[model samples]
Target: MAETRKFLSVETISLIVAFAILAFAGFVTARTEQQRRESGAWVRHTLVVESALYRLDGAIRRAESEERGYIITRDRAYLRPKDEIATQLEKGLAEVGALVADDSEQAERLSELRPLIEERLEQLQHKIDIMRAGDFEAAAEIVRTGEGKALTDRIDALVAEMIAQEDALHRQRDLQMSEATDTLQTAIGSLIVLIAGVAVLAVLLTERQLHALRKSSESLKLAYNELIAESTKRGSLEAQLRQSQKLEALGHLAGGIAHDFNNMLGVIVSSLNILRRKLRRNEGGLDPLIDSAMDGADRAAALVRRLLAFSRIQPLNPEPLDVNSLVIGMSAILHRTLGAHIHLATVLAPDLWPTRVDANELESAVLNLAVNARDAMPTGGQLTIETQNTELDACYTDENPSVRPGQYVMIVISDTGVGMPPDVAAKAFDPFFTTKPIGKGTGLGLSQAHGFATQSNGHIKIYSEVGRGTCLKLYLPRYLEDSEAVEAPPQPQPQPPEEEFPRGRPGEIVLIVEDDEKARQATAQGVRELGYTVLEAESGKEAIRLLRARGDISLMITDIVMPEMDGARLAREAVFRRHALHVMFITGYSQHAIARDGMLDPDVNLLTKPFSLAQLARKIRDVLDARGDLPKGKP
Candidate 1:
């Protein structure tokens, strides 16, 4: 191949050079053609604008000429021509307006032209009428020396301005054409030079074949690195997606648990309340037991709240929470949890960036984690609680399965106690996977912590070694975003047993909008016992049907989570049908019934179900009071 290259004929080399020249010419030709087409479009647009202005100028001139001709002739024939001129001028003015109305300068000129045309037309018509009446001297005086002449002069001025404008535009177009031609010439010359330079470069650069390949090899390495980076990013995203899927699965699990637990709590509380109310009614004694049962029910409520927190199903009411303040607030609780033997030390990062997290949930996670740390050190060891800023990039997230690349405030709880094995630590966040004796420790502690962190848009990473110690890093994502001001808690309004809430009021028309058969009857029956006329319905459909039948209803009490028709839907139908209707929703699944999506009308009320007789009565009375005071709308 080397011998063949060296012995190449001069004629063959000439032929190669000629072909190279042709390729260069082709590229230049294509670019020139594109520029020429663009220039033609610009020229066409300028011509259209100029043509419109010229038409206006011509119309004004023709009107003035016709007026002068009629004044001089004093003939009826001149009157016909004047009318012809007026009609033609009006049509021309309208045509030009349609074309150049979008141009501001032109639009202003057109506005000026309007008054001139009106004055000139009126004056010329007066002169023409005089001329037709055989009053040549008077008509000529009006045309030449009166307001007619002034009007005609203004019209003539407008025509002159229009002509000047068009002439200026034509000159500008000529300049643009000259500029484009010059630019095209320069571009063609530069392109030829660049093509020659490329040809020379291609020849000179090819001489050192190995060196050229070496540079190409370096470029290939760079490209390979870029590909690896892209692959790594893809890998990191896939892992995050998997974590998101896991969390979604967890959300579903939490919802199911919350549903059953809420129902149990509801039953427990309701039954206790019913028993106490009955005892009071019957004049039976046993107040202490009743009080104890109430206390137990309250405790059960707290326990349910904790379960909801652990599952992250409970809405995170994140506020602008200060980390230092939170840690300080938790100091007493942490110390009490760790006990006297364990040396509880807190190393909070100074000027620490604050994160938006549910303060209550944060406190729970910290306290639980500290207690776990205390338990790990049976022989007594130091426990350090440290907080610092953390930024996880793609590289870091790729290695850590649960973590995503983002900002966080890392709260590490390190213990000097007997540490966990790697295998044990791996399953630390798995629910009910604890090594402690039965009844000693609930496996939900660490699991709950992990869930809370993830729920707060962060992750928990635990590192441990069998004999050394455990370092549990709880990454709570840094939330710097501002949220809308949380509205004040709705003041509980206990209604009198007469009007609004269907469950409490007696004699008031109560519309039961519950879909569940058992719940609907219980609620309707309980309302009826309160002396309020209970209207029963198993669904929103039946509730609405009942409501339509009765026009005297004061309040509508509906369970939001209905099968055929939800409470909100029924409430809307009720309000539309009966303008004065008040609504109060009762639901077992409060989140499902009254989520962000389930926005009930502001006039409507909300009452969570499994409520007591007193609660039911009070709510009804309060809602009724509010409804009573509302201003009446025009009938």
Candidate 2:
């Protein structure tokens, strides 16, 4: 009986021990599950914070891009989304702030990020306001200062710091969650060893945990895909922006070409119509009409030349020049151009530094500026032309980023006339941008000057204010060499009637190659009238055949641009066949055909098209008489 009682006691103690072990295991599992739940919640919170940050960043980028688009295109469509973007930015920032509220480090980063964002927003709004006020230059200048970029970069850095902190927390929580899961599995295994039902329950819990893990992984993948899509969208926006800029520039060029060319063609066509009517009436007053027509033609040619200059494609003939001498020599012409009312004065600096530039282009630029000054003051005004040696320093170049710091010869053209506002002065150098009444200006004058200065490795700036006066400062790079400045040639007197149209020699055969039938016929007629035997061909291939068949061809005048065989290639072949053949090239504007790096070869003799019969006759005679003087090798 005592043995049975001892056995019962041992059985009861064993049962109690088993129950205690099961209770301890259950407590451990519950605690571990709770920890895992808390860890998952923190991880989700981190994701929310990261999502808010991304939203904020995207909103800022969109705002910046839209602002730039508005500035560039001046289209109100870009402004339509402004209010929505602003709301998004505000909401995103507030959400980010709320998400990071519990973490001191992240909260501090947010604090630092907020002001930069606000400042950037203010800058954007300021630029928009300036643009709305029609002060595009002021808005552009604000962009140039780089303050906006600085703010953005700072904001990005701070946001990155906040994100990094959140990532670190997320990693720590993930590790804690993993440890909790391992602990839960260990407890469940212990319980499974104690009871079969517990084993089944543990298996079910493991499957549930795995399912949750798969769901979490899918969420992360979705976020990653979203980020990638956003990146692609940003890239597409950048490409569109670049394309828009290109189209804008092309539009400006086309508008300038159309406006100037149409006016010139109108003049030519009107003069011809008048002449025809008068000839039908057998009128005696034909000289003035002929002169007017000729003047219109000359102006058309000059317009093309000016356009080339503005495009920086015209060839330059740089020579060491004393600007003072050039200005003094131009005094009489300036007086005639300005008229008797306008007072013109010169403040020439003695011992002024010399500059290397195209003399004819410089003269043209100066004449253009003077003409602008004259027009600015309809009644009367003082136009002062000044020259001085100056050095542009780094401080100046820092503000005017396009300029270089160096010694320069400065030509200052100041006028006491109605001045321009900041906005007008800003776009003064843009082709076809003008405030002058239609038909009064072509708007190419200042643009041509700007191009000439740039092509000559120089700079130009304008200073003006309403109710004040205007000053244009042209800075040409100083010539460092010690060579004496070339003396200005004396102006040519009017040609005598006998020497006006010098005729070509007898038996001097000239070959004319042009693609346009009318141009070719007119040129052939002009040469024949000059006493030269003319041979005409419509294409380069025909011209080559003519050159090969005729051994006595004295000169070949060809158009530069042609299909299949350009003038340059044709000239090469022509020279290959006849080594001593004299060639002259003519073009309305195709400098690239015969030019190298925007410079015409020294040996090339070129004449711009739309020439008078007298000019053509003179050129033909000169080419025939000057035979064997120029190199006959391929050019």
Candidate 3:
């Protein structure tokens, strides 16, 4: 009886101890689970706050961008999303504020950020309103004050601080969640140890809890990955913005330098022409000096043209061109240019698509490439020019951002010469970059080609291997014809001898409008020497005044770009006053008056500056004689 009684007591004690252990483990697990849920909620809240901040920042940036675009372009399309952006900004800011309400520091940052954001938005709206009122200068003045930027910088700083705070909270919550998970796991282990008969059940329960924890961890990992992706995307956008700014600065620099240099060259060339004309009959030794000076001026003018081309602001005259026919026409010139040592070949595709491009620029680009290829093949090599119909799909255009997905006429120039390495080829099209010996290259050839291609809405790429030679592919968009009305390319006209200068007829008067004093005098003197009466004005207003006073003016040649009243407006006013007054535009660089999208309007009668006397004479004569107004006995 005593042994049985002792056994019963021990059994009861074991059961009681097991029950107590299970109850303790369950209680600990419940508490740990509660802590983990709280931590998870905090983590999600932080993510929400971060996401709202990003959206707010993005909305403000978009609004600012649209505002600037409207100010510059005055296009209503930029303002189309104003209401949508406003909504997003309002919603994003409210969400962020509500989410960060619990944190005092975050709430303080938000409070500071709210006023700045409101001020920025208000400033943006004010500038936009000013732009709408057609007061561009006023809007520009406001931008130049740096007030908007200051507000934006402060907003960015506050947002950064808020995000930093959220990140810290997220980390802390994650650590707490990890600790809770560890504690729950330890409690599960203890429960299994105390309850041996229900070991399988405890293990199964532990597995379920572990699975839930793993799923939560995965969610956190995914959120982290998304954050990393956003950061990377922002970095890429910043890089692209920097590149765009650099290119814009370079363009401005190139344009200013080219304009100034062109004016100087014009003075030298025109003065030289006047001096040569005054001494034409004498057999003086000055002929050689004059010829050399003229040659140098012409070379300088060519360089200026290249610079303009590189800046992508040169005036282009695009015509429907058949690439195959163009290649065939240039065969003789290519043969001469490549020399006898180099073998030139062509693979012209039949029935190729026609593209609209500036024929002269295309010819120049081809010549430049041929010269580069010849230099690459010092000893002698085969050069091939091929044409084909190509299609650039999304896959290709995705890799090349400058290109669009569409049909293109591909011009392939390949050389069996010494090729370029990867590093050298990468920068092959950069202006002023060259691998040739000094004095052998200007380094603008490839860059000019690149700019020309881009300006024409085309793309160019170079492929090379160190040992295998190089290939350059130029893609031009295919021209779409309307109603089967394809215009044939204009043939080149034969030039008259340089000595032949077409003189003006009796009663024909030429009025010259120029901004520069020396250039004006030089032009007036040249026109007078061409046997025509001349008038000069220093500005467009003066030119208009001249036109109002003089009704017998046969031709009014004006600079396209001028302060206050531009040439186009002046021309309109002049034509309104005198219906018969002929208008001509001359410019050191292209302006919006005569050019659109970097192309000269087809109907515009324009003459580029730094022109030789012969070119000037011919252009003037052509404009005068276009209406058959030339008098008898006029050369």
Worst 10 residues of 3 by lDDT: 590-599
Summarize candidate 1's per-residue lDDT along 196-309 as a digit string, tens digits.
766665565455556868999999999999999999999999999999978986885576456545655666676677777878788555566577567667756655665666
Q: State in Å the error of residue 110, model 2.
A: 78
lDDT of each: 0.68, 0.80, 0.78
- Candidate 2 C-alpha lDDT tens digits along 463-544: 6645435678888988866433255321222323645688876688899999879878878887887788889999999999
State the RMSD for candidate 2: 44.2
Clashes of 3: 0
Write down the TM-score of every candidate. 0.33, 0.39, 0.38
lDDT for 293 in candidate 2 is 76
Q: Rank all candidate structures by their TM-score, best first, as comma-separated numbers.
A: 2, 3, 1
The prediction achieving the highest lDDT against the true structure is 2
Alpha-carbon error at 546 in model 2, in Å? 87
For candidate 3, write residues 1-635 as lDDT tens digits. Answer: 56554345544465566677788778887888888788888888888888888888888888888888888788888994556766777888899989988888888888888878878888888888888888999999999999999888888888888888888988998888888889878877776776674565556656776898999999999999999999999999999999997998688557645654566576577767767776887645666657756776777777878888988999999999998988999999999999999888777788899999999999999999999989998998778787877676553565576777677898878776788887999989988778988557778899999999999999998866554467788889888885543564222223346458787865799999877787788788778878889999999789888888888899988875555666667777777788787778776432221242122353578775445566678888998888422111101
Best by TM-score: 2
